[model samples]
Target: MESKAICLGFLPPRLGFSSPHLLSRSPGSSTFATRQKFDSRQTLLWNKPQLSRGRVVCSSSNSESKPETNHSSKSNYARAELFRGKSGSVSFNGLTHQLVEESKLVSAPFQEEKGSFLWVLAPVVLISSLILPQFFLSGAIEASFKNDTVAEIVTSFCFETVFYAGLAIFLSVTDRVQRPYLDFSSKRWGLITGLRGYLTSAFLTMGLKVVVPVFAVYMTWPALGIDALIAVLPFLVGCAVQRVFEARLERRGSSCWPIVPIVFEVYRLYQVTRAATFVQRLMFMMKDAATTAEITERGVALVGLVVTLQFLAVMCLWSFITFLMRLFPSRPVEMTSPLSELLNLDLSDTKKIIAEYIWIGGSGMDIRSKARTLPGPVSDPTKLPKWNYDGSSTDQAAGDDSEVILYPQAIFKDPFRKGNNILVMCDAYTPAGDPIPTNNRNKAVKIFDHPNVKAEEPWFGIEQEYTLLKKDVKWPLGWPLGGFPGPQGPYYCAVGADKAFGRDIVDAHYKACLYSGLSIGGANGEVMPGQWEFQISPTVGIGAGDQLWVARYILERITEICGVIVSFDPKPIQGDWNGAAAHTNFSTKSMRKDGGLDLIKEAIKKLEVKHKQHIAAYGEGNERRLTGKHETADINTFSWGVANRGASVRVGRDTEKEGKGYFEDRRPSSNMDPYLVTSMIAETTIL
Candidate 1:
C-alpha cells in the first residue's frame, strides 16, 4: 500500500493510458512538481473581457499580485434573462428540451451490461461446483475412502477449488469490458486478486457449509422433521400478501419480502430431502435382492450426493442473491479496524483533549493539519483560537514571512482520535487578517454570504468521483501495472470481485465521513474497476463547501492509514476509459417550488454564458478528460439536457415531469474544488 493516489501535486496527465504504445512514468513516490501549473495561476480572475478570433476572451494578466472578483461581469449577468431579441428580452419557452428516457434511468446496479442478469451466473457456478466433487469423483472416492474423513477432505477441497474457479470465470467484468478473473492473457494480477478476494470467500463458504449442517442437526433436530417442514409450506401461500405490503414498505426503506425468499428456500430443502429419500428407498429395495451390502453403501452415497447438491445450492444461492440485493444500495460495508478498539476505550475519566487544526495548503488541493491540546470538550468553532503554520514550506508565503494564520471555521468529530477530540476545518490568512491567495474557502464564503444569495438558500449535492491507484506502480488498483483492463461496459455501480475494486477503502471512508458528521448522502462503485464515488448533498450555502472538503479529508486519512493512494484525477487513465467527475447537483429555494423547472432552465442559460469560467475552476487537466466521447460533453461547449450524462447540465426526467427539482452540472471534474464549484454555481444561478 505504499502507493499514493496523487491528485493535487501529481504530474501532468500521464500519456500511457490514452494509448497502448504511449509510454509514461509512474510517479509513485516522485516529488511531483508537474502538477498543472495553470490550476493555481490561470484562475478565473479575468481583468476585462476582450474579443479574440470571433470569441470572447476574459483572462487576467500573469503579473497580477492579488485576485479580484469579476464584479461588473457578474452584475451584468445577474440582471440578464435566458436570451434577448430585437423585440425584447427572451426566454427558453419554445426551445426543444432534451429529456432522459425511463429505460435509461435504471443503469447497471452492479455495473453489469443492460438486461444481463449476473445473479444467474453465480447460481450456475454453485451448481457446477456441486457436480464436480460429487459426480466427477463419486466412484473413486467411495472406493478409496469409504465415505470417511478422507472422502470429506477430498470432496471439500475439490468443491472449494472449483467454486473459486467458477467465481473467477463468472465475475470477469471490470470497467465495462468482460475478462474472466483468471484471464491472465493480459494481466497476471487478475489471478492474484482473484485468489486474494474470491478464494478467501470460497474458503469461508467451505467452513460455513461444514458448520451449518452440524449446528442444525444438534440444535434443531425436531425442526428438520416432516411436521415442521410441512408447516412452512402453508405459510408460503401468504407470499402475495407479503409482497403487497413489502412494496409499500420499500418506499420507506424497509423490506420484509427478503424473508419470503427464505421461506421458499425452506420449501426447497423439504423437496430436496423427499427426492433424496425416495432415491435411497429405491436403492434399498434393489440391494435387498443381493447378499452383499455393497449396493446399500452405493445407495447411501447416492442420497448423500443429492443432499450435498442441496447444501451447495443453498450456500451459493444465498450468497449471490444477497450480493444482488446489496447492489441495490446499502450502508457502506465498514471494515472493522483494530484502530476502532482504541475508540471504544473508556475516556470518561479525562477532561483534556486534542484538536487538529486543518487547512488548505499552498497547492489549494493539498490538505495540511497540526494538532493542539485543549482543556476540555468544546463545540463552538469560534471558541477555538487561530494557529500558525510555516507557509513557505507549503508554498503559500516567502521564507522570510513564512507564517500563515489559521481561522477555525468548522468542526467535525475526530474519527481517528475518538472521544471529544475534534478536527477543525480552518482557512488561511496573513498575520494582518487578510485572506491568502490559495484560500478558496474565503471566496466561497463571500459568494454564499451575499444578501441576494442568502435569500435564495442555494442547495447543492456534489457527486465526488475518484479513482484508487496502487502507490507502487501509480496505476489503478486491480489494473495491470503497464497494461489496460477490458474496455468500459459494466463497471458503473457494479458489485462482485471481478467488477469492483478497493471497496473496503471506499466503505471505510464512508463510515468515517459519517462518524465525523459530514452530510455524506451515499457512496458507490463507479464506471471503472478502481474508481468510486460518494455524495455530499442537500447542503445549503457555505456548509456544502465545509462538508465536502472535510469528507475528502476523511477519505484521504483513511486511504493513508490503509497505505493506498486515492486519486482525484479527472481522467486517471486515458483512451476509451470513463473519466472521473464531481457532478454538481444544485437548486435554489425558487427552483424547488412549482414552475421551478423554468428557473432551472434560466440558471442553465446563465451557466452557458459563463461556461468557460466554470470550466476553468472545474479541475486541472479536465480538457484531457472531458472529450465528447465516453459519456462526457466536449469541454469547449455548453449544453443542457434531461438526464444526459454527456450534457454540461443535466435535468433529470423526474424533475421535468414534476416541473420541479434540481439540475446537475456534469462539467465539474473529479479534482474540482468543492468550495469553488459549489459557490460559483450558486453565484451564477442566484446572484
Candidate 2:
C-alpha cells in the first residue's frame, strides 16, 4: 500500500482552534500518523490514495485526480480567502464555519440596543401624573381648615405608600419595558457605579418629605392652615424638570448631571428654612391666633403626619427608578482626548518672528498689549530697541501731537496666547528716547537701582484685594439685591452654597498668574461677601509692579466675558463692611539680618515723615476707606504697631519675636498703583 497524508486546515484561534495539521494514513484505513508542519497555507501530498473507497484525496499536482469531498473543501476555503483579500487568509472547516455563524447571532442584539427617545419621555409623564393630583387636594385643604391636617396626611399616604410604591412594584416586575429609559452608569466612581445616583435620589426624597412639610408648619404657625400645595408645587416641578434635563445629559455622557441637581436642591432647602423662620416672626408680631400655645401644639402634630406621608411617597418613587436602572445599564461614551495647546514654536532655523508689546500707562492704572509680527525675537531683551506711541492716547502727554517712546525693561511669556508670543513690560520715555520724568514705573526702577539701596536687594509681597460687581445693578456679584447678606459674618474663606461666589473667576486669575510666572502666593475669599484677595510674594526689583499689573490685567479680561466688573475701589461698599486694601509687605537684606527689628522701626520712622506724600499716591477715595473704623488706621496720622491691622504700618509679630523680618504698609488703598507705592517705600526706607 502507498502511504498518504490527509491535510486538515483549522480555523483561527478566535474561532477556538489551533494551527493546521497533516495526518498520515494508509489507503482505506481510519488509523493515522501525525506529520506536523503548520507554517504554510499550502498542503503537500507524499502519495496518492487508492480509488477503492469513497474517501477524499488531496493532491499537490493538477495531473492527479480530484475527489468530491476534497474539491468542496477547497472551493469553500478559496471563497473565504477571496473575501479577506491578499493581506488575510481563512481556512474553512466544518466546525469553524458553524461557530462563526453562531457568533453573528450572539452579537446582533447588542448592536440593536441603541437608546430610545421613549426612555426620556416615560419618566416625564410618570412624574407629571404624580404631581397633578396633589395640586387639587392641596387647594381643597387650603379652603377648609377643619379637615386640613387629615386631608394632607391621607393624600400623602395614598400617593406615597399606596400609588407610588405600587408603581415601583409594577415596574420592578415588568422591568423589560422601563429598564432602557432608566439605565445609567456612573463614570467617576467605578467601584460603585450607581452609588451617587442612589445617594442623590435619597437626599431629594428626604427634602421633599421631611423638610417641606415641617417648613410649612413653621411658616404658617397661628393659621396652621397654609396651602402646602403652593409651597410644595415648585419643589415637585423643579424635581421633574431636573430629571428630564439629567436624562438628556446622561445620554450624552456628562458627569455634571449628578452634581447639579444636588446643589440646586440644597440651595432650595436653605431658602425654605429661611422663609419659614421669617414667616414665623411675622405671624407672631401680627398676633394672628387667640392662643399661640395651642396653635403650636397642633402645628407640631400636623408636621409629623405630613412628613411621614411625604417620606413614603419619595421612597417609593426612588425605588422604582433604581430597579429600572439596574436591569439595563448604559454604555460608556467615547470622549475626546484633551490635547496640550502649543504656545511656542521651534523656529530657530526659520526666518519668521513674533513678539507682543505691553506697556503701562493711565497713571499706572492699566497694562495694555498689542501683537507685532517682527523679523525675529530681540537678540538681547536688555538692549531692546525703543518703540514710539501716541502719549496723549494713554493720558501721558499734554497734546495729540506729542509722542512717547516705550523702553522695554523686561520680557516674559504671554500666558494667555497660544503661540510663541512674548510680553514686554516697558516704561514711557519722551519721543527723543529720554526717560519720561513722571512715569511711575521708570521712577520705581530708578529708585530700586539707586546706589544707596541697589545692593540691599529689596523684596516685596503685595496683598491685592478687590470686589466683583454685577454690571446691571453695580452690587457685589453674590450679594442679595435691595439688602445685605447675613451681615457678611460667614463669608471669609467659607465653603458653602450661601457663602462663596465668583470662585471661578478667582481660580482663572490664579492659574493665569501662575502660568505667567508672576510669583503669586495664594488667593482666598475676603471678610465681605463678594470681596476676594490674591497675594504676590518675593517679587524683587521693579518686577513687583510688573507682575502685579499683569495679574490685574488677567483678572479684568477674564471677568469681561461674564459681564462682571472688577472694582479696585478702596471702599467698594461703605458702612460697617470691611474695605479693600493692598497691604504691601517689604523687606531688605539688612532688614532680615540680625537686629533687623530696629532697622524696621527706623524705616517706619522715615515713613512717618513722608506720610502726607504716601497718602496722596495711595489711591483716590482713600479718606473714605482709611477712617479709624473697620480695621483701618486714621488717615491723618501715621502709626506703626506690631500685628495691629488698625495702624499705618503693621510690623509682623514674628519680626518682633525673632528680632527680624518685614513690615506691612496697611495704609495703601486697594486702588493704589503698586509701582508708585513701592517706589516711595524704597526711596523712604532704603538707608
Candidate 3:
C-alpha cells in the first residue's frame, strides 16, 4: 500500500547460510500485472540471497546485511518520481511478472476436445503410474511375506495408495490462489484441465518422495506394510476419487454432470484426515512390529526413521507445494480466490468474529440463518447483541411491517467456518418484543424453566429418521423410479452399497453435527433403504430442541451439497416400508434412580392419558405413519408395554429388570418439533 518506489541495493550472502532464498508473495491483477515470459532475463535478479525465516539474514565484516530497499538521495529522487504510487521493489515485481507469464504457458487456456488424441496417453500414464512402482517393489515385499499372493497384493496396494494420496496433494495446489501464475480462475461450465502434467508427475515422483515409506516397509515386517498402508487408506479412499473424476472431466469436456461436485467432496474430507493418517499408520505399524518380535536393532532404527521421515516428508511437501504455487504457477489451477481468507487472517489476528444466527422459519419445519460480524469473541448468549431480519421474507410477517428480532438462546462452534466463529440458535420476536407465533423454543423455554419441571431435570434423546431421495425424481435414492426393490427384509443396518444408500451424506451429516458441538450420539442405516437415523442424545431441558434443530440444519446443508433430498414426511412411501420416527427417549431424575421403575410406570400412565394431545404436537401427517402396523402404535390408541416397539410408550426390559433407567416414547413421527415434544413429556410426567 506504500505509494513510493523503493531503491534496490544488493546484499552479500550470510555466513553459515549460503543457499538461495525464496521470496514468496502474490502478484497479479492487483496491480501492474505481467504476462511476459520468465525465460532467462529476470532469473539474474534472483541469483543470490540468504534465508532464515521471514527476514533475510546476511553476514557482514564491515557491512553487507542491507536490504534491497534503502536509497541514496539521488536515486531516491528518481524512484519517487518514476515509480510513484505503484509497486517497484525488485524481487516482488520482477518475480511475480515473470511467474505470471510462465503460468499462462503451462496451464494454457483449455480447449474442449472430445476423445481428443491426448486421452490415449492418459490410460498409458495411469497404468504405468500404478504398475511400475509395484513391479519394482514386489521383489522386496515377496521376500518379507514369502507368499506370492500377499506380496503381490501388498506391492500393488502400495503403488495405488501412493497414486491416490498424490491425487489429494495435487488438488491442494489447484484449489489455492497462487501469485504470478494465477490470480483468479474463472470456472468453465463443464470443461476442465484435469490434473495436467501433475497427474503423471505426482504419481511418479510425489509417491516416491512423501510416500517413500511404502518401499521401506517391506524390509521391516509383513503386517507392518499392510497396516501402514491401511493407515493411509483414508487418503486412498478419499482421494481415489480423482482417478475416476479426472477421467470424467477429460471425457466430458464442456459437458455438465451433477456427480462430479459430489465426488469432489472427497478432497475436503481427505484434507481433514491428511495430518492424522501419518500418526495412525505409525501406530498400526508399531503395534504390528512389536508383536512379531522378529525385529533387529537395524529394523527398529529403520522403522523409526522411516515413519519420522515420511511424516516430515508429507509436512514439507505441503509447505513446498503451497509455496511453490505462489511463485512459479506454471500450471494454472482453477482456484476461486477466496477473498474471505484475507478477512479470515484478520479474524484470527484480532479475535473478532462472525456469528451465524439460526432461527426457525414460520413453516416451523424450516430452519434459517444469517451471519454478522461481531466486535470480538463472546461466550454468553446474553452478552451477544440482538439482530433483526425481514420477517416477510421468511413468511413470519406481512411486508407492510416485517422486521423480526432474533434473540440468541444458544451458541455452538461453527463447523463450516471454524476457528473462533460460532453458530447461534435464536428465536424470533416481533418489533414490539413479543414472541412470534412460530417461536416454539420460547414456549419450550417457559416449560423448562418451571420449578417442578426444573426439579425433575428431564432428559430427551430423539432418534430422528429420514429418507434420502433423488433430487430430480423425488424417489428414494437407490429405489427404481415407478418401482420398488425386492423388499425391506435385509435393509436394516445393511452394509452393502445396494441396500445401504447415501451413507456418505449420512456420515457427513453425523460428523458435521459433532463438529458443530451438537450432542450427536451415533448414526446407522435404517430398516428402510435410502433411510438413515442419527440420535440427538441425553440432552437436558430445551437444549434437546436446540441440538436437534441444529443437527437437522446440518443435515440439510450436507444433503444440499450432495444434491440429494431429505424427506422428513413421517412415511415417504406407502405400504410395508417402515416409517421414520423422532422416537423420544425420556427420563427424569427420579426415573434414573434405584427402584424408579415404579416412577416410570406412573409416568407412562400420564403419557397414555395424553397420547392424542402429544400426537398432534409430535409431527404433521402422523396418521399416515402411526397405523398399528410397521412398528408403530395406532394413532387412535395408547398402549404401554416393556420392549414393545408397537406400543405408544415402550419401557425397556433393562429398565423393568434393573428397576431403573429410561423409557422410550414410540409415538412421535420424524417431523416432530423437539421443543414441543420434550417440554410436553415433562409437562405430563413431572410438572
Candidate 4:
C-alpha cells in the first residue's frame, strides 16, 4: 500500500504580500529622514495608547539610533516573519524563537476554518471507502456487475471519486475564502480566519473518516463492516488528517495544531500486536485446560480491536447524540396530563429534585397545612350525597366502628351460653415481669388476674418489639430506632377486644380479624401506621390491638371498681435535646388527629351504658360527656403521687379528691362505709 504521507507544504503569502488588500503594511514616503521621524512619531503615538483594550503600544521615544530603514515599515517587516515565516520566526539578531510568543502580542480571533475542512472531509472519505464497499458488494454493486473483481474495482472507484470530488470542492472554497481574511493588511483577515477554521474542520473530519479507518483496516481487518466503519472510521480519518495538518502547520511555523495520529497509530498497533500474541498463547493454554474451539491470532486481534473501537465509538457518539438531543426541543407526546409531564423530567433533574425535597424535609409546613386544611367534597348534612347510602360508605365506617363498640372495655358476650368477648387495656402492661413497676408486687397480680381481665396474659410480652423490629428491618434507611433515648421510652399501648356474640357482632368479626398481628417484615403483616383505610376498620379501633385493649381495660375496670386513679396524655410528649420524652408526656389532645387513642370515645360509651349521672359526657363534641371533675381530680392525685409517694398512694391529695365532680368517689348523698374503701384498697394486692 502506498503510504499516504504527503510533504507539509508552506505557501508563501500570495503576492503583493505587503499590500493593504492582503497583509497590512506600514506606509512609507521617499525621504529617509522623514521616514525616520514618522517612525519615531508613530511609535510614540501607539505606545501611549492603553493595552487593556488589546492595542499593542509601540514605545519609540528614544530615536537617535542606527539605520534610518529601521522605521515603522521595517518594524512591520521584523514582526511579520512570526506569522508568515515557514521556518518559524527568528529575531533579526538571529535568536531562534517559536511563533506562539509572537501571536500572543499579535492577537488572532478564534478561527475554526483552519482545520475544519480536513476534519469534515477526511471522515467522509474513510467512511465511504470502508462502509460503501459493503453495501455495493452485498447488493448494489453485484447487481451492477457480474464479475466480482469488476464490482470491487467499480465500488472503490466510485467511492474514492465521490470522496476526492467533495474534498477538492471543500478545500478550494475554503482556501480561496480564508486567504483574504488571514491577510490582515486589508482588515478583512477575520473573515479568512473564520473560513480557515471551518475549512480545517471539514478537512479534519474527512481525514478522520478516510485516512484513519483505512490505516486501521489495512493494519487489522475482518471486522471492517458497515457499523464498525461508520462508527470508528470518522475518528480514525480525523486522527490521520489532524496528523497531516499538524505536520504541515509545524512546517509553516504554526503551532495551532498538534501531531496526534502518530501516537494513536502507535498505541493501536501495540494493542493489536499484543492481542495477537495473547491469542497464540491462549490457544495453548486452552488446549491444556479445556476448550471448545481453537483460538487464532487474527481472531484475537480482531476481537480486541472491535471491543476497543466499539467502546470508543459508542461513547463518543452517545455523548454527542445526547448533547444534540438536549439542545433540540423534545418531541411532543400524547401525555395524559400536565402533572405527568412535570413528574417525568429528565432523569438527572428528577434525581436532583428528589434530593432537594428530602433535604428540605418535604414541601414545608405551609404546603402541608394548606393540603390539610383544604376542604374536600363537603356535603350538606340534610342533602345526603348518594355515597351516604352507598355500601362503600358502610365499608369505610365499618373499620373505625369496631374500635368504638367492641374494643377498650365495652359490653361483652353472655359468658354462660356464649363465650364472653373480653376486652382489656393493661396499664404499663407486660407479659412476665412488670415493665412499669409498682411498690407492691401484689398490685401487678390484681391487675393481671382481675375478673374482667378475660384471657390471661393477653396483654403479654413486648408487642412494640415485634412491630418495631419488623419496621426497622423492612425500611433500613427510613425507620431507624437508634434516635430514641433510654430514659424515657415511649409507652405504646395496643387496644384489643373479642366478640363471640350476636349476628351483627359476628358479621363484623371477619373485619376485626384483619389485625392478625402477623409479623410485618414480609408479605404477611399488619398494614403500616397512618393508613386511614385499615386503622378505621370496624374490628380495629384507634390504638387497637390485643395488648393495648388489655391495658386500657385494666385501667378502666380499676377506675370503676376501685375508683379513679391516674390519667395519661401521650400525644403532647415533647422530647428534649437528648431525645427523651418529658414527664407527664401522654396527652390525648396532642395525639395525631389522623388516628390516635380517643379517650373521650372510650369514656363516653362506658359511662352511657352504666347509666351513671356521676359520669356524664358534656364536651359538646356531639354532647359527649364524662365525670369531668372526678377524672381531673383522680389524674391530679396520680400526678401528685408520682411526684411525692411514687404511685403507691390510694387516696387523699396524693390520690383522688372527694368532690361533686369526682365520679368514682362515693357521693355525699350516698352513705358508704369506711371499711369498704379500705377493703377495696386492700384488693390492690390482687393486681
Candidate 4 per-residue lDDT over residues 1-687, each given as its tens digit? 000000011122222223322112232222211122222323211111111111112223343443333334332100001111111110111110111121112222222423444446544654454455456554787687987445544644454455434433333333232322232121112222244654565455444445544555565555333323333433454455446544543343322221123323333343333333433443444455543333354445456555655444443344334323432333212213335555544444222211000000011000000011112222222221111111122121233331111111222221111221122211221223232221112233444345533231121111110111111011111111111222311221212211110122222322233232221111111122110001111111112222223222232223222111111111111222111000111112211133222332232233334333321211011111011221122221222122232221212331122211101221101011111221222222112
* Poorest 10 consecutive residues by lDDT, candidate 3: 76-85
Global local distance difference test of model 4:
0.25
lDDT of 3 by residue, 419-532 (tens): 889999999999899999999888989999999989888999999999887553255777632236768779888898568888888888888888888999999999988889
Clashes of each: 12, 2, 2, 98
Tens digit of lDDT per residue, candidate 1, span 438-538?
A: 88899999999999999989998899888776543245776532235677767788888778988888988899888999989999998877899999968
Best by lDDT: 3
Question: Which tens-of-lDDT digit does each residue in 1-687 have in candidate 2?
Answer: 001122222222211112121111123333222122122233322221221111222222322332222212221100011110011122221111110111111111111222233334445544444555556655665465456345545554444433333333223222222221122234422212466776686677655555655565455544545444433443454455456555644554432344334433443453344334333443454456656666665556445535533454455456445534633363322121122224344555665455666777664556566666666656456756667777787777878566888777777666666344566777778866677755778777778889877788888999999988754224576654223567867999988867987898899989877877679999999999988999998788788988887788778778764456788878866567888899999999999999999999999999999899999999877898889888899999889899898999998889999999999999998878888998889889985
Error of 1 at 150 (Å): 38
Arrange candidates, best lDDT first.
Answer: 3, 1, 2, 4
Number of the top-ranking candidate, with TM-score as the measure = 3
Better of 3 and 4 by lDDT: 3
lDDT at position 410, candidate 3? 94
TM-score rank, highest first?
3, 1, 2, 4
| Clash number for candidate 1 | 12
